[model samples]
Target: MGALDGKIAIVTGTSRGVGVGVSRQLLLAGATVVGCSRRPLPGLPAAEGLGGVEGRAEQWVCDQGDHRAIDAFVQRVVDTYGRVDILVNNAGGTVPTPHAEDVPELVQQIQSSPASDDDFERTVAFHAYAVQMNLISPLWFAIRVYRQMRTQDGTGSIVNISSGAGHPAGSPSLVSYGAAKSGLNHLTRSLAEEWGPKARVNCLALGPTMTENFRAFVLGEQDPEGRAYFANVPLGRAGDPDEVGRTCVFLCSGEADYINGTTIEIDGGMLPGVLYDAGLKTITDLL
Candidate 1:
């Protein structure tokens, strides 16, 4: 029997990236996963019938950024399944907004001139959206899932997907995204303490993972600098999505019943400031 046999799970942002990997692993562990994305569900390219893994997953459309949509989605799950045992709040990313697209130029414009009220309003709006998506939405999911879990099993597990960009050092380009994720890290701890003995909550702060979008934007020959940067990482490479998924399974399974309110770093040993260009040069020069 699979480790998660008979369990029901809800995975958000399963159209691609970490969401796909998490869903694949849960299904392999024998959990029934209901995966959601803003877009319609795409075909499963990785975990379909591989080794005859018998776990099941279904795709649905839900704009997790919207609270009303989240309420509807959670209600739908509880109505159909009667209970929710696991929640992987994975629906988030550094989405580009108007204020974000030309950040350098915009910043220069604001600083070089008398910044208008409209400029400040637009900037705040952008940051607000980021916080809503990365921080508030996950809490919304957890609250709904926890409520349902309390009514039945009372042993539900929540895994919030985070990013290394959320580190206190933060990301310059991903300022809003990082801030929102940092908030999510704290949220995990707070919720775990609040719901303990009934359910568990945890977070995973991820580093570079080879996802479709990453491959397109960061890994190709066109981005040699991006490719070279991996050498600075301790592992000298990006993480696999399945790697993140496996960790999620371990956290959700009976094996991790005692692990609560923790945020595990799954970045292949890479950390900010400790390793960068200087470190890479020393290693490369020796070789």
Candidate 2:
């Protein structure tokens, strides 16, 4: 039997990227997965050797930035699945592009641009206010699910997808995005403490992975810079989405029951200042 046989899960922002990868992994592990994104996803074919279990997946359109939308989305999942055994909060990102170091001049331009009061509000809304959508919306869903899990005397798991950028100081261009993820990391710890033994809450702190959107954004259509970017990674390559999905599966499984109230870095040994020192030869070559 699969590890998550008989389990039910909700994966946010699951139409693509890490979210999509996580949804697929959970389904392969025998969980009924409800995937939510701003729109319907292009359907994926059944995995080889996994035909019978393929159709157990469903998708819902949701505006993660809207609290009511998220609440309704969760309700619909409960209505369909009967219960939520796992919740993966993976729906957040910034509106801007590239790292600050990659585009400091653009960052300065956006910062210095004159704006109407409304434009200023809209800017903050997209950056800072949007974070509440990512952090608080998940918290609300967790509360509602916790109540149900407690009533059933069942255990549940919550995993928030954070970022390595949440540390390493603020990337001026991604200031709000990093701040939001940092808030999520703290929220993960706090919720785990609050939920205690009934439900486990954890954060997955991720590093640069070559998702489809990321490839398009960073390397443009030609992908000329892809190899150069990968060279900077200590692993000498970017992570595959499945690597993250596998980690999520483990964290949500009974195998990780003893683990809680922590942030697990899935960055392929890219964090900690040591990785840079360990890659001294590569760094010098690049320089």
TM of each candidate vs. truth? 0.84, 0.81
Q: What tens-digit string does per-residue lDDT give for candidate 1 at 241-273? A: 899999999999999999999999988898764
**TM-score (C-alpha, index-matched) for candidate 2:** 0.81
Error of 1 at 32 (Å): 0.1
Task: Please give, for residues 140-178, the per-residue lDDT of candidate 2 as tens digits.
Answer: 666766776665556799888887757755544455667
Give the clashing pairs for model 1: none
Give candidate 1 regions above 4 Å deviation: 42-55, 95-122, 219-221, 224-226, 273-287
Error of 2 at 206 (Å): 0.9
CA RMSD for every model? Answer: 6.4, 5.7
